[model samples]
Target: MVIPWLSVLWAAPIIGAGVVMLMPRRALAKWVALAVSLLALGVTVVIAAGFDPGGEQYQFVESRRWIPSFGTGYILGVDGIALALIVLTAVLVPLLIVAGWNDADNAAQRRSVHTYLALTLAVEGMVFMSLIALDILLFYVFFEAMLIPMYFLIGGFGADRVASSKAAVKFLLYNLFGGLIMLAAVIGLYVTTAGSDAFGSGTFDFRAIVAAVAAGDFAVNPAVLNLMFAGFMFAFAVKAPLWPLHRWLPDAAVEATPASAVLMMAVMDKVGTFGMLRYCLQLFPDAATLFRPLIITLAVVGIIYGAVVAIGQTDVMRLIAYTSISHFGFIILGIFVMTTQGQSGSTLYMVNHGISTAALFLIAGFLVSRRGSRLIAAYGGVQKVAPVLAGTFLVAGLATLSLPGLAPFISEFLVLIGTFTRYPVLAVLAATALVLSAIYVLWLYQRIMTGPVREGNERLRDLVPRELAVVTPLIVLLLVLGIYPKPALDVIDPAVGHTLTTIDQPDPAPTLADGNAP
Candidate 1:
């Protein structure tokens, strides 16, 4: 059973932030942050170890009446799915702090970074809680609370303050609009439930409402359902940074530093996809089915468009921004297929993307530290001056291209294979996106590392010991997850399979697209 560590886990990062603020020296802040993350990670591990795979109906659940006036409660729980992300958050935050050690920002900036790091951990905790928040309103609160730290990170630590803050404003406005719309949908869900005695008394419990809707006890117009689905999906897609609505991502990534970028690109971005899995499918299955084709179209478009644009990027950061768009396109493709393999692949992709992206961003950070610029043409033959650094980048970049032995390769393969059953033609098109990834990944590598050295590049040094401490674990994780993904998958496969079954759509039987069999 899932036991509630909601209080403990939530308290860890906030306390760590307080300690960091109190600590006088930068060295002490680093140690404090590391210690806090490790502690929280241990707690997450303990929660993971205690999780019972067979009994996944929200274990470690702690629910109490809190604000009965609005029909909400202090609710918390975790399933295998939420646990995986919680572990990912705990593992990544400390690594991000260590990765940022080489940043040349001023003392005030460092303070802001440390405080932001703490806030990120705090946000991660809320995201963790919200993942399993069974009550609708409680879930909404934790969900909206994540924006605070992210806004500061992008606005405060971004490369060009003016531009970064502008991007943050755009992101805030877009998401805020989406969130406000979703609130209306949430109110609708509550109002529909009000006819039942349990809900008529004003309860926001999701399970009861789902039961009421399913039994046709809740009289919701089909049109109303469709509108609600649109509201929720729009918010999630914007967050997923799906095409059309994804304009915020590239701009934000371009301006933010590696550490801050990791928060936005790696952790926070998953919220969109997570919302799809949890809300769209979980709460509005009919509407999700209705919207499938349109969403899939956008996903495939993003896949190809992102790849094409990335190939033309002149700046490394901008190129990475586009590459992520290309990659998440596959993720959404897998999710829409509505099969066990597809959903599981999408989940695995979320985790693997976090690992691969952290590596790529960190590598970008190293290059920036040396060249003082992110333009691809700003330096060449960096390997001559910093062989270790270039080699690390090569490894990371190959992984980005989904090199066969790396982490992304396995997850990307699973997603593509999963999609072949439900979307033969789209899956075929998705394969081309991988090819484009290879072209740009390698192209980026060659442009920056293998050509003739440019002037002023001779002074760049290989990764120092401190930097290695930050990067080594991420690289090792990529390899480890690639070769032996059983631990992660054991959690993912069953969870995703269970989740898909919960939705209106069940697994679509397979038909091999490569012409092996019908």
Candidate 2:
């Protein structure tokens, strides 16, 4: 029965993709994606309802043979962490589709509706499966599979198809090259464990490797593990678009439709962070320890740099893209801090970011739809015309800036608390970025949503019923989760605790910029 349920979770979105592709009307395509997202989300909730948080091993797990000779099988399971992301994916997919309901205003744009819809569904399915994969090879497969749909999303459904395609290719190349390196590393890992296979064959089973490491059946030298870790981290770094590698993100986000931007920046982008959680910690604990300082440094730099750049951006979408970089910085810092609080915060940050970032991107889409521009200066005093739209924008803007009652505030606060215990100076520096975030987010809000009414701005209309329907749930979730994050944090804490325990490392104590470890 669980197998049946897992199969539905995997297949439902794909089926929706097919349905959308088959439908003649763009309207039907939109609804098809929405229905599929809701259906998959429904299945996910049911899985959570049945999931016992106390279960040590993965529940609702299903494993069946796909390649008998190769010792490869289709194995899937959900612990609390994967399930949380699955739920986030389910929530955002529909929001993206609904947010972009009017994105394609012309014939050329209309033609892309089905393809974009289908690709989004496919990406959702792939990402969900990737998070649950027990086998390393399977995880890698699904991980790379996500790039396909996202490539189409950014490339095909973008604001300028040519620019989008170029960015897509850039995105694809950066990811694929990283994947190839990881494949070599995966193969190396498989070969190293080839002799221990009970099936008289090598495998890419993640759990098996963890067991092997624990049992001392094989020992990985720190150096070799470091190499593989580099390959894996390279892939995830590009995906996370960490600081220096983040150039591609702003370009792609600016070029993308709000739906594409939301899923890309919020959903698909989380894949990078997820990979760090699952792969870096699971596969390369020693390397993680070895590289923690460097990665943490990158994370802090991204936090400050991203915030500073966001302040300078005059384009709405570009500013949001930069905010993601800053948010990711905090998330990465928390994860690498390797403290219970840090890991928990990082996990919570992922879920909260999904809600908040997706909402911001969706709001930006509506603004563009009305104003026909992505420039921040394009309109003024829009509150005079569209109070509802302006109000929603305020919520989203405040949420992005991590205002105290919003979902991100709690998560970001936890990250700071956790990171400070291990990296005080860095945490303080990263904390400074928050003040800057307030500056950009509030100033951007004031400039775009308030102040003097422009000469032609009086015609702007408030959020309509359908648009309100899409935004209302996200806003409510934002407030509810903000005030009471225990429900999400409960599931998150255990997984993060387990992850840190598996690695068996305490966070390093905070110290000065010099080598002194106080």
> Which candidate ranks first by lDDT, i.e. highest?
2
lDDT of each: 0.79, 0.84
Native-referenced Cα lDDT, model 2: 0.84
Candidate 1: residue 387 Cα off by (Å): 1.5
Candidate 2 error regions (>4 Å): 1-3, 105-109, 195-200, 507-518
After TM-score superposition, the amount by which residue 270's alpha carbon in candidate 1 deviates from its true location, in angstroms, is: 0.9
TM-score of each: 0.94, 0.95
Error of 2 at 355 (Å): 0.9
How accurate locally is residue 71 in candidate 2, as Cα lDDT from 0 to 100?
Answer: 61
Residues 426-501, model 1: lDDT tens digits: 8898899878998999989888898788888988888998788878998999899888988988887777866676
- Roughly what TM-score does model 1 have, to 2 decimal places? 0.94
Supply the TM-score for candidate 2. Answer: 0.95
